[model samples]
Target: MASRTTSWAYRPSLDGLRMLAMYLIILFHTQVPWIQGSFIAVNLFFVLSGYLVTNVVLTEMERTGRLDLGRFYARRVRRLLPAALVAIVGISLVFLLVAPVVRRLGLVGDAQGSLLYVANWRFIAQANDYFAPNVDKSPFLHFWTLSIEEQFYVVFPLLILLLARSSRRGVMVAGLAVVTVASIGAQVYWATADPIHAYYGTDARLYQLSAGALMAVALRTWPVRLPRVGARAVAVGGMALFAVLCFSAVAMSQSNRGFLGTAACLMIVAGLMLDEDQPLAKALSLRPVVYLGQISYSTYLWHWPAILVMGMFLDVGPVTMAALAAVIATGLAAASAELLEQPVRSAKRLNRFRWRVSAVGVACSVLAAVLVVPTVLEREQPPAVASGTGGAAVGKLAAAHSDPLPKDVDWDRVDRDRGTEQTCQVDDLDRCVLHEGSGAHVLLVGDSHARMMTAMFEQLAKKHDFTLSTNIVSGCPWQENLRNTQSSPKRQERCDEARTGWYDTVLPRLDPDLVVVATLPRDHGKWHQRLENRDGSDLGLERSLLRATRDTLDKIEKVADRTLMVQSVATPRSFVPNDCLTSAKDPDDCVVPLTTTNRPSDAYYLAVAADVDAAYTVDLNPAFCPAGPLCSPVVDGMVVWRDNQHLTASFVAHQRAKVWRLIQQTGVLDALDGL
Candidate 1:
């Protein structure tokens, strides 16, 4: 066989590898069963990119004795930017037409980030959890991979030029090795410390690219010539290993992803080294596979947004969604390839123009996208009316008149009075005192649900003449040494730290007369799905919640004379904010049925509180959802729920008498009076 560097022949097997990687990615995105770990396909692409790009750069350098940076950049811009700009502009237009106002507003930032090729960093800064439930999936999320590749295209060539000037090919190989090691180290560290950031950041993912660069350098400088039988065996075996890893249900984490990256590198190396005549190579060179590979770039670009756009209007099964996504993505990719990509790629005249026209076109489109989307979003906002009275007064006025709804409902500011923005509500476990009374000391402990009640609790604390100290973290349950899997690893670790810090350091320091524990009890499903032990084994939902609830009660009982476990609120099936309700034909349209929601019942809390002596459960569901079958979003014309699960401070203020009575019934006030 002719030397690859000497011949520069198009390798169909490489195209096949690309096709396989693309399919795996599609499968991963589609959430196919037994392919949850197929996100490793991205690692495969990273390696392939490093290899191919490095090979091209090296071949050019070896042939000409110097690199053509201008041509290189123009090639990159022509190949990548046109399709990406099309996707962004196209998606932005669609979002304006079909998406909800809040989602449309968000698209402005997504469009900006994607167009600028910094979306990965944008997601990192936003702390966007890829795996979180009910998260609005960004249509431009797939652009992160493109961003990484584009970034590499910019920096890698410069580095290659510098290395070529300074030393021989061996130095380039060594430099890539160093880069690979450093990047892998960074990946491991960040993956453990902050997995979301690690997953998206270029610093952590650079090693995957470096691995390919190293392979390219090796193949050119010290080409391996294995026996035909050995080459075939290695190629088949490497693919088998890759398949096994990709098909397995292994969790994607820092500890295990290094192995996956290594496996991907091995597969790329084998595919490159094997002859085209080998059975594995021959299968990969098939026409259908090669065509898919040819259109892979545009397919990847369009598939995610296509899925998101389709989902906006259609409620189809996964199979149907996947089919539609494939078809739409393929169609768009073919059009992009034939109409835009191939033409720009072959235009030698445009290359001589140094990508100036392309650059200006991209700049103008991005500027237009940034301006237009936000303008549209701002225009969509409903006009605000100035009202002297608060939501409570407005509620009373609406009740009395029974004519038209009042215009003073500020749904956005519903949680504003909840004191989440207080200086003491830091990310670390710090106590924020919402109310200070001259009587007994009271401490509130739990998660966001606990924080949600602070507004009402502060009012209650003042009414009962007790000081309140709140030690709470959002999304973390008040469970002692218990892991919450639903949250990110960083969050879970922080929760554990906060709990330990409070119990060991803060709790002993602030010995309150009463300790109230509250959390979103409906999160049992999240816990069931996400909670894991230190060893990463599942902590069954019922058992974990039961144990955590009992343990928390026992721990609080030892510190406080009395303990109260506030039952989780009635989580409505849907959240229609007061802003949306203001335009409703009938205000009752905002009412949601209690039976349809998956909130934990009072019985569940009763069972949890049963094991702890003197531990009482306070059910606030009746006050929030007084109507048996239906829970109205508006009670007495004031919005009952600020969002879906949390009560508005104004609504909670109105329910103060009932809540005070419940606290009195628990004898917590009596206990406070004695203290």
Candidate 2:
């Protein structure tokens, strides 16, 4: 029952493993093909942290008869917090000076979260998709992994103390095993619907860390039972398979992440059990490789911010960026470890004053947060919903050709803010805000395309004395038994769930005078975008669109007095309009012809609208796009879109006066008048 009291040995090979994992992280961030899909590198980080911390705690207890938690925390703080805070403070300063406010929109909050070891949960709260293509990724995004490990450090020590009555090795192993199994189960359940949550959550990722914890308890003596051949085979083959997964689409998925975590654990075991003579072990033990591992902690901290900062100045390909970021981060990490990290880590005076070190850690975190206050205080234009009596100001604008880009505009708001309907995802289908104060009710439904219409609806609702609410999501639209093909299989499950939720749960809650369906229609998903019923077969693109539209309308008609469908605006062939206008000498240069290539076919959407009786449709494109070959992004002195497809909420608000006229022209509101 006695736990072994072996001295902790420095394993160069494990450090080598650390180096390799760090490389994978750098490569993934740099958008290396195939590698970007993998989560193995992140799993390996959790395993290493769990294994080493468990070893240190158990070793201390076995040798001293009691765990000194204060000392342990002081050590952890010195090891992690110093370099992390420096990176947070230093990188944030760079962002303040170099990056525009649009790029630095959420950096203040992100830096604070990163400092306090809560960035992981913060991301989960924000519904951040780690894999989503964000043009303005937070510099502190990498800090989420560090936060998870820090959480384990704080909790694991207390857990051991709770189990102090039983010091048996088997008991310790069993305790960790139970947690590992439960963590894996939690991951499976969460991964089914919200993979982003599953990916970043401490509870879901606990098993990966526990894998190493189990290894630490069961194999503390560093003894190898396997022969050279078996060790070589297991180590080489497991790593090879792991590498293959990292390079394949299969490895990119969060649900499949367990396999990668297991593979990492197997590799760690092989590294320990294999003798120094083994090829994997010997190669990993080399001084140069081990040096990278030695500086790996600081390197991980520096990598992402360095990439983003360097990206501002360097116009390079992915490979070049990856190489540049790696070199810069490694160099900086190496120097920081030598000059700053190691000095603080080994300071005998600081180690002696445990309470003081903890105090210093807390103070540093607060200081880092305070550093960004100036930027946060800077006044910027309000996002989404406007700030005045009329709403986001639709001031008289000059001609579209000569009007320069508005300096006062907040690009972050345009890109990020989607009003409060953001909460009413399919997962929470009944979450839409009901404006009970107003006598008449209006509903907006569809995808992000529909979300952009919020401001216009708000305007109409205010003027017409009606209440407006939206049931919209970015990639989800109202469809029966459907999925978004652009979305992953797991996302498809959520999409389908959302469809059922909105129709079966949300629709029946409140009767609305009118329902507006606005979506960018395209042929995608399971069952040809689920055009047919559950029992029916695929009906091609056109027939399928008709069937889907009919199904959606049928549901709306059940509760809504009238239904109004929208034909989405024209898509420009040029780059993101806001970005284009930023550099274009003339605002008109941002305009591009609505070519067949960039323009999506909404023929099915229009046909469905026309065919459905008692269901009116609106085409607001003519108000914005002139009857010509060119599609202007600037309309009525406001930038029409935040990006390629979604209209800016502010722009929509500004155009509300014109939009109301268009709605009046459609006679959809005339029916509202009759009501």
Candidate 3:
């Protein structure tokens, strides 16, 4: 039972494979729009790493007669830790200082968890919810991959050592094969069950690494010595195949995962096993490609954040055209490698004291991350709560220090009270707040849609010495529950809880002077939105809106005072208001000009307004949606909306003239305004 090292097995072909894998990585991240399947490069690396590391460890144990556990771990620490620490610290700082509310985005989960490599698990928990995917602000989201690799290295070496005790070669080979097979199976099962978590899961990815380890063992025992002609062909064929695999892997849609990934990795390994003396080998081993391979770690670390910052913050064009960005990023990464990575990697230890100090620095980072995330969460407003099941609450609540609502909500206490109900149900928005002041008592109420009008309400309140209040809650239908109680699961439960809570907790508490309710009613979901109409066209949108309007009027009658001021449904715009405004020739002409000859129609809101006006006698729609088919997103040099759908803060603030006058006409805020 001799180790592979004891029995003549060292191959530069593997380095050739590493070269190919890294090249794929470069192309994948480059996302050179033409290179569709570049992502498959990661799979290739996984396979190659699995095979090579396994081979090395098994071979070492068989030949040396004993495993140096401490040295093995120390080597791993030396190879991975310093670079990782530098990257994490550097990225975390960027997020903390440069990015707005970056720490609030959940950069590090509970502090200690991120430092200990359990950030993966924390991500798993968060990612399960639809809203949780982008929750974290950490620039180190990519570190989960490294964490998985490091975790595998830690355990796999120990497993190989144990298996090597009995006929080292036989057990080592068998154990690796068994693990590889099991890992592949797990991948297939979990990928289907929970693709998001499974994709990031270490267990599902182990087989790819094992493939490389197995290759290491096989080459050690077999010794691939090809004739010049044969060697050249193998090498060339492997290289070509590797390139094909890379292209193929990246080109495929993210949906097709299992078979393609396995096949791609296999191709990379075959290429790596080719002859060292072959032309392909000589080319790959050249100083440039080899140097890139050496510094690839830094390249991978910095490339993504560079792209993210450019795309998200700077509003860079499509990722396909991010070449200049990539270039700048690459130069910086290379410089970091030379200045930071190489120094730490090649340095001789000064003393045990220095090592201890470095360890403490690492610990401090985790502590800081933990403390920062919660603080950020506390500062933002929470989402409104739609009515739901009896015992369960729908939205996440912000604790004492963190505001669930934004600061602008505070201009009117009435809005804050309405926001409280909304926040109780949905955790997605900021709760409205009211500042300490002397003013008219104006109340705003409805669903999440009404929350957008806060700026307008606050402006009107300030100008007229009126206090503003809101009755908006998030997620819950301000109109009515469109889903049938018997059919819908989440909606049914939510509606019931909201109904009960509104009647019990909210209704009796706030008897404000005036109420303004806004709602966008619609029936949306799998079957409802897809059903056909009388003329064989889709009438789902129209029907859904109509139903929603009816439900809204019903709810408004229950809570609103004698004179309810209802805003007319404004024409929906599809792009951000400012982007459109900025693109226009003159900022004053901030309107989305209409192409269709017909007047803009919103069936549900119009219907609800018609019914409510007839019953309670108030018309606020003309102030907002007055006149022609064209809807001016910005009126009289003022922007009305921040985004495509909802009213912007600026728009809300400027609505003072129209909104206050409407309230005066209706006599809704007379009591609070001292009229």
lDDT of 2 by residue, 563-628 (tens): 777765656523577787777666666654443211112434433443344566666764555522
Q: Which stretches of candidate 2 lie over 4 Å from their true place?
A: 1-7, 102-105, 221-224, 249-252, 370-675
lDDT of 3 at 527: 35
Better of 2 and 3 by TM-score: 2
Residue 465 error, candidate 1, Å: 32
Q: Rank the candidates by lDDT, best first.
A: 2, 1, 3
Candidate 1 lands at a TM-score of 0.59
Report the lDDT tens digits of candidate 3 across residue range 1-675. 111122335555455455555545545543454554655566766776676666566557767977766556555565566566566556555544334231223444523344556655665654432111111124455556666777787798788768767775766678878988898787778777866666667877777787767767766656665455664554455446546645543454343543466565564455445544446656767776676666666666666666545433342333543564556555766887778766755667623344454455456546655664445432432222112112101111211111112223322332233222342323321233342236544456555566666666666556656555555555444444343333255744554555434533453344344555555433333435432222344434444445544555555456544335353444344355455444544433444332221111222332233324322323344455332223455455444554554555554555557766765654344444443
- Where model 1 places Cα greater than 4 Å from the true spot, the runs are 1-6, 251-255, 355-358, 365-675
| Model 1, span 1-675: residue lDDT tens | 332333445788787888888878777677666665677788878888898899899889888988888778877788888888887777766655554343454457767888888888887876666543223467888888888888898899998887777667798888888988899888888887887778898988988888888888877777667767676766777777677677646555643765565665566455555555787878888999888888899999899988876754454666777788888998999999999989978887786677675576567657756775567543452212211222222333344222234567565576564534221323333446677788888888887777766777788777777788887776677766566666787877678766754565566566778888777664443455665444344555544555556666667777777677777676653444454466776555555555422233333445444324356667676576665345556677666766665667667778777777766655445535733
The local lDDT score (0 to 100) that residue 487 gets in candidate 1 is 79
State the local distance difference test value for candidate 2.
0.68
Question: Model 2: how far is 256 from its true place, Å?
Answer: 1.7
Model 3 CA deviation exceeding 4 Å by range: 1-36, 55-63, 102-105, 110-114, 128-138, 225-259, 319-325, 350-675
Clashing pairs in 1: 485-530, 485-531
From the highest TM-score down, the ranking of the candidates is 1, 2, 3
Which stretch of 10 consecutive residues in model 3 shows the poorest summed lDDT?
Answer: 391-400
